[model samples]
Target: MSQTPRYQEIRDDLLARMCDGTYPPGSLLPAEPELAEAYGVSRPTLRQAIQLLADAGYVEKRRRRGTVVRRRKVEQRFMDALMSYGADVEAQGAIPATRVLQARIQGASPEVAEALGIGEGDPVASLMRLRYLDEEPAVLLRTWVPTSVFPGLLGHDFEREGLYDVFAESGLPVETVRRVLEAALPDPVEAELLAIDEGQPCFLFKSVGRAKTGQAVEYSVALYRGDVNTFTVTLTTED
Candidate 1:
């Protein structure tokens, strides 16, 4: 192979090391300068190799912390179905729990109204929660439900179970959910609640779940710890 393919070769070698448990999960790898010297390549070439590893989910780059090997991701199926967060976590063999921080009836903010497709000033059930996985805080979820669909939802104790479970118990059938994911810096409140330092990046998700009749039932905005969780989507060709 040509020397131009050297970066690819380096990336492959590093990946092999990871697979063979040389670096192990959560272990920091050598700096670019050290790696470049060891591999007989320039810093840019070494960086390109590192980028390949990072993109493949084998490693992560933190601001103050150096590059570290990532733990194996929990493989979650994205089937076209509605499932509760508790069920999903249990399927992965992890204990899940939710702590309700706040629950109340609130007027729809402009952002909530746009997402839920409801008029401004309409009443919405605002539910804020801190979700835990195996007793570790994993995500901060804030959801708004149009009161017109599920009246008096704010009166229930959501900390004991997921909102989707309550919906099913109330005879609501969720047929479709639209989700968007992005990265954002956690705000002060979010940072405190999520137990993350300020300016740290978090995965932000906005989801709109609708009933079988196509009426929007819930709009949720969630922040997940970037270091501990990852979202995976699988695509197959439809015949």
Candidate 2:
């Protein structure tokens, strides 16, 4: 009988722990020396296991923090469907939650103005929020809609209401949405909001929603934690 490779043994055990939540996401594993001693293996052997886990997206190495267990990445389906962030999270069998940090009427900046096709400094209802899945902060969202479109936009309890749902309720429906995705490192506030290290990379999504008449209704920007989320875009040849 052949003996099992030491690294493979360690790798399987670590994966089991991750499944059982023993080493939950965002939690740091024990120091290398401690882990090596516990497993009665050399640091190199333990590292082989750790590398496998990292390669498989089950863990990540932080700049200052050691190897940290990563959350199961949520796959977001886009382009083919205009799914809300909350809906996409729930589809993964995780509880979706929102924390509305700030909501008010403000003047649209040039960036927002360009996206919404509104004039710069135009009065717009702005909302800032943090999106969570299964109690883990995953995305920071900022949205702006011209007050001319939704006069009472800020009056809704956004903590419990999805933005598009509100638009539909107001007798205006978004018929189309355009999404632009980019990769970037999080800024200080965004890093803090998403509960990720500043050094960690994030996905930046900018979207514009338009009404059936081709009127821009909503402009949103989102920062998604790259470690905890994945995106999917489906293409079809059939028109």
Highest-TM-score candidate: 2
lDDT of 2 by residue, 25-126 (tens): 778998889999999999999999999999988888776679988877889886579778778888788788999999989899999999999899999999
Q: TM-score for all predictions?
A: 0.68, 0.89
Cα lDDT of model 1 by residue, 70-150, tens digit = 765443343345677788778888777899999989899999999889999899999999997766677899999999989
Give the runs in model 1 whose Cα sits over 4 Å from its true position. 1-81
Q: Show the colliding residue pairs in model 2.
A: none
Q: CA shift at 184, candidate 1, in angstroms?
A: 1.3
Clashing pairs in 1: none
After TM-score superposition, the amount by which residue 180's alpha carbon in candidate 2 deviates from its true location, in angstroms, is 1.7
Candidate 2's C-alpha runs over 4 A off are 42-44
